[model samples]
Target: MSNAPSSPTGPVNRLAETTSPYLRQHAHNPVDWWPWCEEALALARETDRPILLSIGYSACHWCHVMAHESFEDPGTAELMNRLFVNIKVDREERPDLDKIYQTAHQLLAQRPGGWPLTVFLMPDDQKPFFAGTYFPREPRHGLPAFKQLMQGVERAYREQKTAIESQNESLMAALAELEPHASDALPERSAIDAALQQLDTSFDPEHGGFGDAPKFPHPTNLDLLLRHATDAPQTGAPDRSALAKAVWTLERMVRGGLTDQLGGGFYRYSVDALWMIPHFEKMLYDNGPLLALCCDAFAVTEDPVFRDAAVMTADWVLREMQSPEGGYWSSLDADSEGEEGKFYVWDREEIRALLAPAEYAPFAAVYRLDRPANCEGRWHLHGYRTPEAVAVDLGLEPARVQALLAAARATLYVARERRVRPGRDEKVLTAWNALMIKGLARAARTFDRPDYLESAEQALAFIRGTLWREGRLLATYKDGTAHLNAYLDDYANLLDALLELLQTRWSRADLDFALALAEVLLDQFEDPIGGGFWFTGRDHETLIHRTKPLGDEAIPSGNGVAALALERLGHLVGEPRYLAAAERTLKLAAESIRRMPYAHATLLFALDEWLDPPETLVIRAGDERLDAWRREAQRGYRPRRFVLGIPADESHLPGTLAAMAPGERPRIYRCSGTRCEPPTESLADVVKPTS
Candidate 1:
């Protein structure tokens, strides 16, 4: 298959008009790329040629490599353009296509799937019969050259038409088997215990994460652990061991290279088991849940580490990622100037020259300057020793040592600003932006940072002003173009974010926004005949298949978030229909919940709430201070506790809490499903749980 290929060249393509930054990145490729649309598919069917579907996002490193190698090479591009209808898709913009093809890829390759996914689909129904990731421009590393592979695939399709159709028929059957489990019973609360037991099998006790090398921080699983840890003492739950795991993982991640110590964000994941080497992409989606997790960890453990991490990550979002208007951008790429980690790594001599001798001593010892470089012969600044250890080694006060390192880190950060930076995908995605707003709102309330809340409000206002048009939501916005129909995740996640935002500080407009989104979720996305919601809206363009997403992958499952938001909004608005929808969705996934608890962590959270409905605490403003009482009430990790405060001058009461009207004095009312205990003025009594 090794053959001498023609030189690489460039030509503009139809992708120039695409809204996605990912697609635009390939506008000048030699491959004659066509945006994923009817025209491209129509041509393939008319010519009886196969479709080459290349799917990836903007921040993907290997996606860029493949484009440069095969898509840019004249010979490979010529072969691709001649043999198939070349379609380029931004996975972020078309997750429905990505999800369907990714499953097919796994089935065909019998391996896990990832970015730069290359799939060859039948022209008739867009059903994929062959799949792979990142083909070399020429033969290398035991993989066939791109041109050779294309030739082989084309020849096989032409010569073995009968066998190919037979195989696709079997493949179609395999795809159908991936559907959700059908069950007659709701998942029992005992499944939470089962999940924790299964999670323990992969839990790395010493390192504080799941499994081995190429570790990903599964925020969903960590969230389940945090909630379980918080309720263990009160409910006698067996997942008390979750606390140690959560704390250990958070601490290790913060100390390792996975976190951008100089810049104030986290890389996507670690390339090694110890979290020492990271993939270097900074994603807004990953940071959002991670920040929320850090805040919850701080609340549960009172660990200064978690608090510091939350502050740093939030600061990074505001500093580097916020758009010119107010929305948060999607991601920052892992590479700069054709080299991965170039923007982040530091030279030892450069560090020494940038810092004072006194500053360098402690910083060097703490950050492992004495050890071999981890990335391309340059240090990535992962601290090897704790501040206390450094203080002891330096024979100095811990506080003094901390001051020195902080000063040194500041200097290093300034010097790094002079380097060429990784590309930023400035597209503001509705679902991703909502995650950040929710994270910021949580941080604002938990850490008492009004600035954080202000940031959230700014982003929320931007979304409302620009993305919402004519009573419908748009998914991605970049350079004043917002076209794609918003999906279930956009509405579901935004509803969840708004609910969290409302808790921090009540605003009727935001509340109305939440209500409107819920209406859309039920109307446009929900399965009226079955249960759960589809990934695309009813108004969305008809595709080969409409998917009802149920598990967490890359982000929280749309179905899980929809169920969660419905439950919360239902109770807060006194809407029975919303609650019923939530219950129906949960019932649909009951069997899957019992079997794979960790994979379906977010759904399990919703399931947990269903098992035990939460109590609503409405505090009426009087002349008394709210510090001690509020602290005691929120000290434990009570995921089921709902608290709201209203001033005495307030008048409008929503249908959800009409029972707790404002009064002359500051008082607290605890209500559960229309029943309320007498109002209490005493803080100590209010702090006591049902126990």
Candidate 2:
């Protein structure tokens, strides 16, 4: 599945020289595609041609559809090549570019942007003046034909050049105002309560998610609710009902079509409000946060449903998403063969023929295979009944119902494997891998799963070896090449991941790596006086607008993660430099955090930690009791807590834990700021909250 040219005579573009899997995907396209690099930008400026920037990821269905419809067509390619300096970018590989352009598209068109982003940018500054998404080959569905759009754009540039330039100027001004410097006023209890109140209003009580149809897994927002449910209960907060929202959303997502009922993993999002009939693509980013949430949700509610989802998603990653090199792959495409949902959906007759009479009835009854086809003429399986309900309906024990359902799933999953599988985008992104590593480590720590911890450690080892070069990080790795300047999220996420991984399994190397990441973050990404970190490193290419993102989108906020990671590292290592940076960033983002607390979710969480920080417990022991106590200490989701075990044999425990020298007995010390409490042999004593 390569498009690279073997001979000089072959028709290929500059993408053949790229490392991005998405860029290489278009190497054989009829369009003369140029990777988003200095050379392409230079060519556009030198030729006085407007830039046709098309941004998308490889696994995006609409991206592939547009590529097939227009980029691969010789006639359409001619129009593109002749009139514009066509540049292609994989959004995953270059999110800084994507972020700037997506926002620019929003400003110019006054609508939200999506993948297969089509924008006409001025060659002088690469500022978008006109923008759209997925124009058809022929004019249809209120979209201009690809050729027609290009010709019109060319005409606008030639005849209406002044108007386009004016629009570009206005767009740039709008972008500048996107992040106005607000007062360094921190978000308080009222702001946090308001965010919860907002969620309550937007929450879909019947369906389990926020907002209307085409629902996404807003993992950060859900996590915020989880935090509120746990922390604000004692505060007389406006929304003490948050726990219900978090638990209900997690449970329903697992039971609905959004989750892969047989295979274990989640789809990208649901098209319908009920979370039935998802878009079908599975992303590592979505699963990782969801996995961590499910783990905490189980602990918070004492519900097996959350545990089931957490286990299923983890198993799916270990079984399907993880590469042999220990790095997690990017995504699985929504469509298989030529149709969407073709791989996972099943026909009733096919299921009935494959299963035994006893199995078929329970399977159909449990997974809603008995209901009318919800996806075209095929059934995309979702849990139609709870285990208790299935048990009652089938006249069997609850345990027996679960056993039968498990067997049925195994049968179905094996058969599904024989079908045409969705394509896997094997490009391993550093930020996404870091998120998964964190999720895996958190789950392992919560559940005391050695295998999950081991897997996370292996992935971290791979990341350190492959992505970390010199003292800095690389954004992505694929086909034995690690290129592109790592963004703030890469350093921030990996730092957070190393911190999490340290709890599961301590290592001097990982600690050293975390320190280096922290240093690089401060040195390269931080906006000193202004406070938050920039999306790109200081040495990276200058874009139209450098973003210091505070709000969560498809991913958690980078600046928020930076503050959280630095604060934790600062406390754990006794470093003032890290602590100062975290405080400054929080102060910079404070007002935004106050106004839109839900949008600034991670920031608010960081603020909560900063104002009244979590205890950093360093357990000095190696015996079974120590391990049990470590698990016991982390029984619930305490977002502020960072519990680490320093086995008696462990060497190079950070200087903060120097007092905890290995002795005959295992002792736990609760360290907060620069103070350490008396060593405790009892788990209950160590777990107690400090007055």
Candidate 3:
């Protein structure tokens, strides 16, 4: 795949009218692209031609490469159009399809799959026979040329029908076998311990991240570590190693090119282990959990690095990603002006030109502008030195150096804004929006930022007003139209976000909405017999396979989030069914978590909560003191405690909350699982650590 860009030279296709930004991106491709629809599938079956399915997202750099190289090439497009019924799908819009095909690709090729996934499927059964990602326009890197591969696929489909059928049957059987079965016994604490050990083994102590190059945010792992680290003191021994790993990685990420030094949002991932040189796409999903992590880190350590990181990220999200209609935008494209990172990278001369001598000296020293260009002969700003170190070198106070650097950053940001900005995917996806909402809510509560809370509430209102129709949710909303059956992630993440939002600020309406979504999860997504949630809802479009994913992926697993949310909600509302479902899900996922603990970090969290239920705190107050009391209760980073501040006059409470009636004076009622403590008026007594 090449970073070089070329103009598309084709008439518009059916994808021009699609809601998905990714699908619309390929509207002008020379290949006769049909948006994944029943009509297109029927056309393939009627013609008895195999379907050529291309799955990718708008911000994916390789997807753009493949579009420019093959989909836009008239000759290559002609071959594709002639031999097969071509269909284009936005993975964000139809993750169910992406999940199925990507898994199929892995099964067939025995390798990991990525975006720009190309697959050849029998139109009748929609079963894939061949799969790979990013086929070259010309044969290179052991991949067949687009035209040659297409012709061969067509020939094989025609000549080897019986063998293909047999393979399809085997693939179907294998896919079915992947579904996790319910375990007779509950997962023990050993699984959690083993996961921590695995993380310790993979942790790059020198660099502060897991594995080698190509470091993803992996917010779930960080969250797990943070929770474990917080729990260490109660065990009579402090596990500083876990906290160090999480903090160091976060610090490195904030300083490195993975974070936009001027813009304040994180990029998709770091291409190098040092967290420098990122794959420039800015995703809402990545930033949300990251924002929460930064907030938690700040709360845990009182580190200015984390506090500053959280503030900047929250500001960026509110400034750029939030839509006029209140929902968060999906992502920012990696490429702008036909070149990757062109909008973000800068020349040393540009920095010098933009700043005064005093400003330039501090800025250059801190951002490594004095060093050799690290990103394609241009600098992508990363912290190479501290302000204090630079101050020492320049014989200036740290405060003075900080002032100069801040001024320079502001000046450079104004100049950078003049350049062609990256394209923003304006589609408001329910799941992604929920993730952002959770991040915003967590940051709001941690930092005492009402604006962040307001932003989160607005996004939640947008989802509730627009995405929620009748009783179900529409997955994505664009151009005043909301459509598509919501996935498990949508329901699960939204439920989780609502839980977070409730803790930050009490909302009876939001609670009702949360309960409704929870019901949808059980009714539409849960696999009652198997004991976990399916990726697609029961009423969703029937694909070849129904996936009950347990492990975390680019986002946390829906099952993991569902289990965690249900467990918390069940405990909060005193709902037996919710608790039972959560337990069943743990039983289903226990084997997977025990086998590959690191991969199942999110599920492990649910397991952790199951083994030791979270403390539920209900604060009842009539006046302004409610906020103060709640804030005081949240003095430190207590991950295992859920604090809800409800008005004294508030009526129609849930069973658990209703049991603790509000008194004339503010009171706090605490509960762990089914065990409850007597209501207390003193906030300090509730927050104080037990001896």
CA shift of 663, model 1, Å: 1.6
| Residues 74-171 of candidate 3: C-alpha lDDT, one tens digit per residue | 89988998899999988999999999999999999999999999999999989999999998889998988988989999999999999999999999
State the TM-score for model 2: 0.95
- By TM-score, the better pick of 2 and 3 is 3
Cα lDDT computed for each candidate against the true fold: 0.84, 0.84, 0.90
Identify the superior model by lDDT, candidate 2 or candidate 3. Answer: 3
lDDT of 2: 0.84
**Candidate 2 lDDT by residue in tens digits, 537-574:** 98998888899888888889999999999989988878
lDDT of 2 at 477: 86
Residue pairs with clashing backbones, model 3:
none
Which whole-number lDDT from 0 to 100 does residue 623 have in model 3?
A: 94
Query: What would the TM-scores of all predictions be?
Result: 0.95, 0.95, 0.98
lDDT for model 1, on a 0 to 1 scale? Answer: 0.84
Ordered by lDDT, highest first, the candidates read 3, 2, 1
Q: What is the RMSD of candidate 2?
A: 2.6
